[model samples]
Target: MTEFDILVVGEANPDLLLRGDVRPRFGQEEQLLTAADLVLGGSAAITAVGCATLGLRTALLAAVGDDFFGALVRDQLTTAGVRLMPYAAGGVPTGVTVILSEPDDRAMLTLPGTIAALRPQDVTDALIQSTRHVHVSALYLQPGLAGGLAEVFKRARSLGRTTSLDTNWDPSGAWASLDDILAHTDVFLPNAAELSAVTGAANPDTAAAQLVALGTTVVMKDGARGARAWWPDGEAAAPGRPVDVVDTTGAGDSFNAGFLAGRLGGHDLPESLRWATVAGSLSTRAAGGTAAQATRADLMP
Candidate 1:
């Protein structure tokens, strides 16, 4: 039997979230207000942590530099119950993200570092065969991984493993190199803005249809509206769970974990979507991505 339930491949970094009066003023003045937290970050890392918390045997395969931040990342992943299979980075610097957080929205400044350095060649055959499902995130940042992920997913499918992709946000707005990737991907997870950006559709509904036509299941996170899925066999959606928002960081990644965990546990599309909605909403209860991530009991009880 395959050992791991999910293999999350992509970025690893720490996020420093500063909340309350975080608007930057550039007059050489020091200002601070409410809260600041340095916590585990990166979409793939957060998703892996969420999956592990949701009762999946999860692993993270990504590069983290041999530095203090890298050690921190390792500690965070291990503590979260996700196995860390670190890539040999030749002592590069670990990546970090600084976020100015608000209830409704947030702004992030990231140092790409090892976050953008993960490559497809690093996804070994052993890793693919050992996992029932493979999930990749932050394709926009991992430019090296982006170009070659289709083949990696293709190989996973041949081994009877399912694959999913969440190309966080393309910073340059180019949105290149997805047609082939989606062809090999079983599930394509994107937020409404990401969906529209990736497919150039007038709206997320049209974007989902466009991607579904390409033979991949489309799970589009609709922010406050919740999540919707379109597959070859069916379509389903769930409305957002009501909650007082905290930080939206990593909420989508948490949603990815919930949906994947539900599907791997044999839940139907609608129920899985609902699971994803609840997970995502609950994640916002804390400052960072993985802090308030949901467990099965949290979702059920």
Candidate 2:
């Protein structure tokens, strides 16, 4: 057995969430009608925390500056039982995200900060060889790291470790190197829009097929509608579990964590999806991104 169940590679940051009725215009300001909170975020933060909460022996490889935000991030990860490796330079500032959410929707403004410093050298071979699953996240934003990251995944595959990817955001939608990354990805998780953007597919089925053609197992997430997985064996659809949603920020991460947890525990694809949907639904009941993330007790089966 591997020493760690999952190793997440990405960026870590602090997030400021303003909840309730308050809107900020381009040139105008607004008054707060609700409350605000400071919490941990970034793709790696949410995914690693979710994995740990789901009873996985999780390890995180991310860059964090030598500033206040970085300190807080380290402390929070430590409290969450995530093993962290040093990856940032001294004196740099950690990344941050400012989120404004109303009763029905939310918008965000993110500063990459030290997150931009994350490079391929930060992903050590020992770490890759030690984990059962190695997940690479937020590829689009770190174009510089993408190529090298691909090499790491390729090496991990050669070592027999399962590889997964979460292409979190693609603001530009240009995937000049996406195929290279997918070639080494055993599992590829992308939201509907991101799938369309990456595969240029008019619909979900085509997009999923396109990803599988690139040699990856596709897990396509469609908000509200549900999620599906496609591989050489064909496709399996998993309906979304209904819930009283409070926030949707960490839903996807929680879903991934739950799915991986189920897989590690020898569950079938459908069973994994069921656990994933439940975990995602549970994550919406709190304030921050991972606020409602479920533990082993919350995810029975």
TM-score of every candidate: 0.97, 0.95
For candidate 2, write residues 241-296 as lDDT tens digits.
67887778767888888888888888988778778777877888887867779888
* Residue range 1-301, candidate 1, lDDT tens digits: 8899999999889999899998899989888869999999999999999999999999999889989999999999999898998578887799999999888888999999888787788998999999999999999998898889999999999999999999998888898959999999989999988888888886767788888888999999999999888998889889888888888999999999999999999998888889999999999987899989999987772
For model 2, the stretches where C-alpha displacement exceeds 4 angstroms are: 26-28
Query: Which clashing pairs does model 1 show?
Result: none
Best by lDDT: 1
**C-alpha local distance difference test of each model:** 0.91, 0.82
TM-score for model 1? 0.97
TM-score of 2: 0.95
lDDT of 1: 0.91
lDDT of 1 at 263: 95
